[model samples]
Target: MTTKTGDQESPLASQVDPQTSVSRVPPPETPAAVQTRFRVIAAFWAVIIFLGFPIWWKTTSIYRASLPLEEMVHWADGKTCRPVFPLEIHLSTPSLPYIEAQHLLRTTQHTLDDLNEFAAHHLRLKLANDTTGDHTGQDSSEHVNYAARETPDTALTVRLLPQEGLASPRSELHAATTQLDVFYPPSQIPVSSSSNSPLSTFIAAELQQLYGEEKATIAHILSGDTARLASTSPQLAEDISRRLRRSMKYAETYHLSFSLFTPGAEPSSWDIEAAVNEYVSPLLQALSPISNFTVDTQVQLYANFAPTAPKPEYDESEAVWTLKKEGLSAFVNAAEWPLNPSIGTGPTINFILYVPDPSQSPLVVKENSASSWIVPQWGGVFLLNPPLSNDEQGSRSNPAHLSLGSLGPAFMTFSHQLLTLLGTPSTPASLPLRLQTSIRIRAATLLLSASSTMGSLARLTESLPSIPIPATVATSVSTTLSHLTATCSHLREGRFGAALASARVAETEAERSFFEKSMVGQVYFPDEHKVAVYLPLLGPIGVPLVVGLLRELKRIAAKRKAKAS
Candidate 1:
């Protein structure tokens, strides 16, 4: 037979001839080769699934702190709680009989229901004891807030009295207290059967006027409904909004940033501390009920005009130096002005009294010849053209010293701006009453703002999944929720100062939860890369061990077969 190449299977196969039993080499190692291949695959798989994968996982995984993501998210959603303001009005009848007083209250309530536009804010009246002439009044707390709501924390006290000369009816508002004095002619008192009466109409009008600003403020805070504030004149709406914008958000404390700005460096030091105490101390003291204030005065000289600002022009028509009203918005020169806010807990309300050089004296509003203008919620600008003084020789410098007296007008403007920025309404005259309203306004603002922030945080968490939730986020959420509860409780209790404090905490906590660090980590690595790295070391070391084991197994099997035969 012709010998075949190694490729030919006949050459490798064992053949027995008739003349002799030919022992041919067993088809060399086909079974061993297959066994070696399986063992090599098993070795790689064993290393990969058992050791390599675990180590890689351990190395690459990030530490994810336990967080109450679900709870935090839920609180942020409106599903958790709906905030409501329930105001109670106390009604006292010093002049009428108990039955007549009760009837009048009922009629007034009915009329009020007819006039109310917003349903969320409703006034409820509680009858006082007529037997004891003393209607319960709130006891003074260590905190001497004029409008402190104790004695049931009624929003307003209504005193019904009989007036002889009044043709129909009239009401007088006490500037000091939230008390409205209603004078109705004795004859207009509602009869037991009458559901509606002229007395009720008078009561409705009186109540409406008293709460008109508050209603507009609430509406603006709750719904941003400036248009609905038409009941308050448009000028009032603009004034209120301007003040609100200028005013710092409700805080436990406000940083009073009093800055004295001058074009040149001459009078760097002012009797500032004294001036502030003399002029501003009373206003601050009056505002103490709503929040605390920290005062600091800074004097910044060499404050320059912006390049784009219009230079002072001598107006022949008015015989005064004029600055265009349109140009006033840029007068602050924020770029160069050192009116930085004070560093602290509450917002920095900057009070800038810019002293134009003596050369630019008698400065007036170009359009109106006005001496002063308010910078919305920012501050006020008052041109202090001090009367030109004569030296011993009767000559004056190009500019004059900014007297402590000149700062009076500027400070006054600043005070007005400060009030507007503080969200103080314009109608109420008494300082204490305004502060009480401010307390309520701040409380309402804080509540609504925190709620909206919660909603935003909930949405943020939902939209992004890769970010890890830290335990701190959960803690912050719990803090926010608890504070929110406290704030609401304080609001209902008529502890607005306390409510604002709680709401501040809530706002801070909510912000922390929303901006939690380490929440986001990138995650994308290829599996093929891991396999290529691990396979090289495993392949060479695996072949021999697998082959030896397979050979031993084969020898054992042959010996067992021979013995059995």
Candidate 2:
């Protein structure tokens, strides 16, 4: 009803206020506020760049010590060291004049040099100097002992003697020592003007034949080319290959554990101590020069076979129980047997003497009726078939305790097995020479093994960039290389004992460096996992900071454009 101007104005004002509320704009930001926002963002980015990033990098970076990678690789590739064997032979001609001895030595050396095909192995003959000068009735051993103390490089001593009515020259190698006795006619002695003689030729040929197997074996190991060993027969090569395949790796010390495992309760105890002393002690003593050994014995009864193993079947034709040849691998009940290795740093060779129950007495391999077998680098096993006897109740059973006489055959087999496991060659009949061969073999094996480990470590570091290499590993590598050098030098100089010692050090250091526990931790924590862990925390904070920075940069750019216009 009141059509006044105030009422009309009020309604329009209300309509205008609604429009203004719908389309309103805030006030422009002051330069101080913009500068403050920019400062805040710049400060945040500065903290992240200077403090947080450095802390993260410092905490996450891996330590990698500088290594002689090239030198290691060269050594592994056989470029740094070429192994050589310089065997020294002493000529002890107590029955001949010095001039004649020197002439014979010259002729023999000439012939030896001509016969030797492998340059890596050469023998040098030196005349023995008789310092005592009293050769009336001194034992040969005494002279040998004195010479040994004088010069340890004497590999073999040749004692030349003139015998009565000898048609030709003949050599007899001493089994109890490292001397070769040669008997020849008095007229066969070489003159100084003579370039060669029949006696010299015979001695040279004998020496060559004696070291033929060793030379071929070394050639095979160094080159792996059987063609280089043309002097060796195919059968001999195959035998050497098989022996190498079957032999255990080199170690400074070895633990020999003799255990008597039986399926039944009887035959629990054995004369292991006496048997070992009789059969194994001499071998261990002989091998002490190459490696140290610790002997231990134990007895386990009622050691049943594994459930998954094949059961022995009774053959009526043979009237005995037999195990399948293929099933011998599972015959040892590892779970039930207490054949644990002895506490030591080196490997343990376990020899188990298993006795079957009365019902399954005289167990033999079905294929060939063999009673003993080798586990191939593990150990040996012997099946003991004791003579059955009647108990008080007239029940036939195995003896309760094995006597020393009853254990003789088994211990002898174990001794042979031990020698085989140690990679002893079957020739020359001289135990000392065989042991010397073992020393060289062990040195070579350790050198190659350590070299292989070094190569593997180098490749591992290259392939896995994230793995941390500790300083200890570096030190170990250095030690290994140094010892490897010394080993090579010792081998070149024919000091096999020193070579073995240096190689032991090399092998130990190489193993320690390659098996470093700290190097394996990074393999489980990868870069993707790191990204996943950090993304959530960084994403929320990073987005706002980045957006503020971009906006500030755009505003400054626009202000500069305006000023330029």
Candidate 3:
């Protein structure tokens, strides 16, 4: 019903107007919609913070061992200790009066100082009053293995003998003992007043010459610069390089593998144990102070070269069966040689006695016809061509039997080659002296190598923080640090064998820690993978939630402004 007129009153203002119908549809359930939208967002954020964040943190963090990083850096920086060689010299003069002996010792020390070029390694002379003190000192030094030098720790004992030599002083180096027999011409004895003399210089030069090779080697190692030898000579530098290249990496125990390889089946059997005892064992025994050698012998027959390897060609110029110098390295036929290292901790040094077939006897280097060459940190090979004939069993000839006696030359050559490979010096006629020098060289080498390794480990950790540092790696680092300390201490004590053993352990541990497989596998997720996994889920779920939140925020801001107005 339409009412009278100033305005038409619809019976229902309560009835929906067309404009109101368009405008008010349950107010679009705004508050409930907002609360639902908020709950959904809060749930998503909770999952992201609690689930995603922890997973990312746990996955990315490095398992850093409680390493003494400060101490390690300190050691690497050379702040830990300055290695000094305070060598003790026990001067025992039973014949000379005590006062005279002391005087002689003082003069000799002055002479030694005058000759010494290296300040780190020096001789401290202490006059021994009694024979028992010398023995006791030696035993205690060996047992306790103290780093500090005390009495009876002399490297060499000079026995002053008045001999019938006419012209000058003479020195005899004892092969067994660390004794130098210094015979002064009776006319040349130092009277109470002489401050300088020719005899002293002569003795100094002789001793210097004896230790010269070792000094150069140690210098080469310490400086890490062979170019220092350019001032000496290019030839000397080349010689130094050759020596270093041939020398094996230092180890506590060296596996001395004696392999008898033949192109043909004959000469398969050798009296190896006896040959080793006679030809090799003595030298190894002489080497005992430097390293422990475990010897194992095997005979590999029918060992042939790879097909791609250059075949041995007869050299008319040399008039012998020759292997080209280029292929000489491959001549060993390593794939076929059964020269596996003896089972042990130290590296294996192989000594191969390759007996060529009767047809190929007298094999020589195509370039030099040299019978021997080194395999560089491995071993040496000597082509043995025993007088050939087709007469005996297991032999193409009578020499095939090759009694333990026959191996004498081959093994002797091998022993020499082995010494070279083991970093034994050629100078200083005394074998014991050479071995001792070898010990010092090895200790220096290991020390440097281990230090460099630590530096590498530190750098690696710094570069890759995401990698997992397992407890094993921590244990390994600790082991390395401890062994390195032990090695340094042993070197100071002049217990070279113990030092080498410790160094070997340190190297192994350092390698193990550095190459931890688990640590290497982090930071490797591909970009393609991240895109493949997250994009699909995030894109679909993110749009509506973002729009709803924006709308609710705008509506709340407008209501607050209107209420304030």
Task: Score every model by TM-score.
Answer: 0.75, 0.88, 0.81
Candidate number with the higher lDDT (2 or 3): 2
- The C-alpha stretches of model 1 lying farther than 4 A from their native spots are 1-59, 62-80, 128-152, 191-193, 226-252, 265-269, 397-406, 488-498, 520-565
What tens digits encode model 2's per-residue C-alpha lDDT throughout 1-565?
A: 2234744554445546666777878799998988888899999999999999999999999999878888888888999898888888888998888778888899999999998889988888888863435655769998787655444466888888889899999999998788999999999998878999999999999998888878877787888855665678888889889988898887878999999988888897888888998999999999987888998888888889999999999999999899999999998877878877555788999898988898888899999998999998989999999999998999889999999999998999999899989888776788788778777778887888898899889888888998899999999999999999999988887787888889999999999999999999888898999999999989999999999889989989999999999
Best-fitting candidate, measured by lDDT? 2
C-alpha RMSD of candidate 2: 5.1
Candidate 1 per-residue lDDT, tens place, 363-470, comes to: 788887877776654556666565655558675532344556756766767677777777788766545556766777777777767767767765666565445667
Query: Residues 172-242, candidate 3, lDDT per residue (tens digit)?
Result: 88977777787776666666687656655666666667666776777777775556432335666567768
In candidate 1, the residue pairs with backbone N, CA or C atoms under 3 Å apart (3 or more residues apart, or in different chains) clash, namely 243-420, 246-377, 246-421, 247-421, 358-399, 467-519, 468-519
Output the better candidate (2/3) by TM-score. Answer: 2
| Candidate 2: residue 376 lDDT (0-100) | 86
Query: Cα lDDT for residue 265, model 1?
Result: 60
Best by TM-score: 2
Q: Candidate 1: lDDT of 350?
A: 72
Candidate 2 worst ten-residue window by lDDT: 1-10
Question: Residue 438: error of model 1 in Å?
Answer: 2.9
